[model samples]
Target: MVINTGLANLNRYNLNFIIIFFYYAAIYGTIAVFEENMMIRSIKDIILLVISFITLFIIIFKKQQKDLFVLFVLFLFYIPIIIIPYMFLNLSEQSLLYGLKITILPIVMLFTGILLSNFIKKDKILNCFKGIFFIITATWLIQYFLGIEKLLNFGYEYGINVKHFYGYLRLPSTIGTPDGYAILLAFLSIIIERNIKNKKIKILFFIVSMVFILSSTIRSAIMYWLVAYITLFFLRVLTSRTKFIIYSSLLLIFVPIFLFIMSKVNNSLFSIHSLEDRLSHWNLIEFDPFSTKGIIGSGLGSVGASSVKLEEINRSLNGYAVDNQFLAIYYQIGILGIIIFLLIIFYILYVFFKKRSKGQLGIIIIIGTIVSCLFTNTLEIYPYNLYFWFYLGILIDEPELIETEY
Candidate 1:
């Protein structure tokens, strides 16, 4: 019986490893040749499906009742938001397919996170992530010194695809794009700050990480880091003096640096043009608050990546990409959809805040995520959403669960 139990545990570990391996692959594996390839996208979908299936099996086999319950609750809550909008909006088949791909793909991450916490130690997870960050950051630096395109076929769109404004090359590292790299490091910085023990080492890491993030030229990432700093202060992790010093130092050093970079990138750091464009996008939303479509929404795929494809299928769609998450839901899902979305986010906040005593890193990560979402629909995008749900699982799970033997 002991041997049988050991075998089962080994099987569990093996399955968990596969899920995480593929999860990261799906996030960080960038091949420009496959950018618009349907086959490559399908393969990624298949991976997510397999991970979800294995996660469900393990949850059932192990009688992880709490996990099962949470999964059920999320599915139940999201059903109307996804379904009603699709139906009410009459989204095209292509659009529906595209929308669901982004919307549903990351559910696997939640399960993966749950299973990962159960099977692995936090320290082990941290070490593994550190290795990944190092590899990616090194690649990013290589791209900066020697162009990524010259080094390999895999090149950042900004660093290679588009003409660099002036000589600036916004290196994306392995995270696929400039914005993605910044967002990724934003979340990573939280984890690093929380896990590192030595103050001087932590400070060094912060300086290095911030440099990488700023070099990405993603203004939202800059905002995310600032918000994270303030959030950490509110959590009492940083003393008032430390906060003031860090803020002052970063502002003095990086503000002009970002301004100069943005100027060279053809976008000013304080570019009113960009802000106006964003506002114009928001103004395009025309839902009738009293109408059913307005109340429930157009549906999941009605507004984003899938929506663009939908325009090809139905000319009336003329899909627009609203970088803002709040507006995206308001346009696609309607008022009820936004309500449901807020409720879900609030629940995540509640869980993290409740468990903040033990999950301070998780709390900060979620806070950063919410802040980022305001600007870029982090919950709707790939990898970013995956990270959000993944961390949510980590935050909500009982501490005792992670302590249990695999």
Candidate 2:
């Protein structure tokens, strides 16, 4: 692929942005471990806001593509839906700003991805992610061997405690949580499956990923990865007869082992109480046509991990950490906002399906994320949320950029 100097520079700039996002959590974790000013972590949001404005500026002045325009419009329409809820709820100004920060930044990232897709080559994107995966995996391994005391020191500044499962410390690595680490590993697994041609190397990577994911002890992440890979296996990895044989062999050989392992993990692996608690919490948020909260929601930033800092708002709303992404949106934005969000998501999925040959990886990841969202607020999770929207933009349309063989 031949590239002009300007385009090459743009590509480098865009790639650097992605790298920054990929390591944002790790950098914060390192700083926290050394007892540096924890407020620096909040700088990430400021940087994101700046990037959003820059992207908006560029889209307005340079690239006015019809699709991009439509997306911008949809987001514009959804903004009011959320704002009205905040007014009705009488939330503080700080809460409103926080709401806008979380909601708008991800949408801006989608714009960034679409605009930069042509400049950044597909192979370069994969290679960048591959390097990131290896580096993060190394950190995870080191953290695993560091013992709980050392790991606890890593996030104590942020009030994040070390989590354990079945007497094993859930390794957060450079990421802030085991769930985040596992989710990142799961995403890397999809990329490896789609791009790596060497059978032995691919198998090795898969084994590493699986071991780390299991070590994290995040059932939702594990389930998301399994569902995504199983779908990929049938769609791309094997012919019909081969798929049947391989699947049958897998069940026969692995199911017993899996069951045995689960028995050992017991409550950690299968917690009925946790499941019931989640369901009960979900039930508590159900929409009521007669209620103001049901019609317009409690308002954006009314409840969520971000809202926890707003002690008065959190207490008034009786908000704990909302585990479900969809429910979190519903609690903040109301029914209309969620409907618009779902429509946008489905619209993106439709575009992905239309270009399935080129976008199958996107399809698998989106499906996996949606499933993960049911059990956890995947969208609120840093880096994952950023990359998720960015990739959706990258895969939404066919880029005319040079492509190398997968």
Candidate 3:
């Protein structure tokens, strides 16, 4: 089941496109450093639209007729779920388009990943990821130690202020936000752990990843990393009771130390107070599932990050800042939409479980992502969201493509 690692059988055109797309996605935040350049910022959106259209073309004209039909049926119902809500809510065209793009991006990237699995070598993709990991690690280290204000101010223009905890800046690196950067590190760490066989190098990479993620001070990402590693350990690396006992003993030893550190921080940022504020905010947002509008939704772009562009609507809806990804979907698309979203996620997990090849990493990442969505609108985040869906398609559809380089 090993996938060929050579480019001889690869589709050069598709490989080039995927390479461009991923590399661009990797550096997307750096592009935002040029705050004065509107066109440069817009390139992210333009490239996204191009990818979406290209995905549509692949769906329409590619040889996977059965998959095309399934996708067609899925979107046949899915598009109207988005559009009808927009029309009913009388939202602006800009909002509608923006919403549409954000909502469908996962699907687009999924197909793109499928195309990637077929057209490109897995080693090439892994190499891209490794390269991205080093570059980001270097930049993040520089940003954190040097206090690079420009990098720190990356997302301020978008109203996302730099975060701080205990006199330390929650470094965003080049990813524009600490949370997004943390998410990226979580995924990269998994890839590094699974692919890199050198024990010392793997441990070094893990340590650096932890430091960077910890520097970000994103509790969810930190938890995700913990869970992903534990899942990987239990499922793949170790199957013996002794191994479990050893892992449990380590957790027992570290849990108290970790709690002590949290207690000492005394900052509300990582404390239960922050979580209470989130829950209280969620309580303020009312959606009557029994109502007609609730059945469909308030509309796309009526909530979450994309709604920020719809100033009036966003204001009227109290900025529509449903931080939880699931709640955001429910706010925008209603009960049916939420149901569809859950079904998609569960279905993917189901497939991964049943197929259960070398995709334990994928399963772990997906599980971590699901947990992450509970705390933040993960799908709304750039690069993380793109990588999330892209890897979903690749690892799930072509699990064999994920091979250990060592």
Candidate 1 wrong stretches, greater than 4 Å: 1-29, 34-37, 57-71, 147-167, 237-267, 308-317, 398-406
lDDT per model vs. reference: 0.64, 0.70, 0.72
Which runs in model 2 stand beyond 4 Å of their true positions?
1-8, 33-39, 153-159, 234-267, 309-319, 399-406
Off by over 4 Å in 3: 1-10, 65-72, 148-161, 236-270, 312-318, 403-406
Candidate 2 worst ten-residue window by lDDT: 397-406
| TM-score-based ranking | 3, 2, 1
Task: Using lDDT, rank the candidates from best to worst.
Answer: 3, 2, 1
Q: Compared with the true structure, what per-residue lDDT tens digits does model 1 show for residues 97-120?
A: 677677666755676676655544
lDDT by residue for model 3 over 343-378, one digit each (tens)?
777766776777664667678898888888888887
- Highest lDDT among the candidates is held by which one? 3
lDDT of 1: 0.64
RMSD of each: 5.3, 3.7, 4.0
| TM-scores, one per candidate | 0.79, 0.86, 0.86
lDDT of 2 by residue, 146-231 (tens): 87776656444322535766566776666666777678778876766566677777778778778777777788888889888766
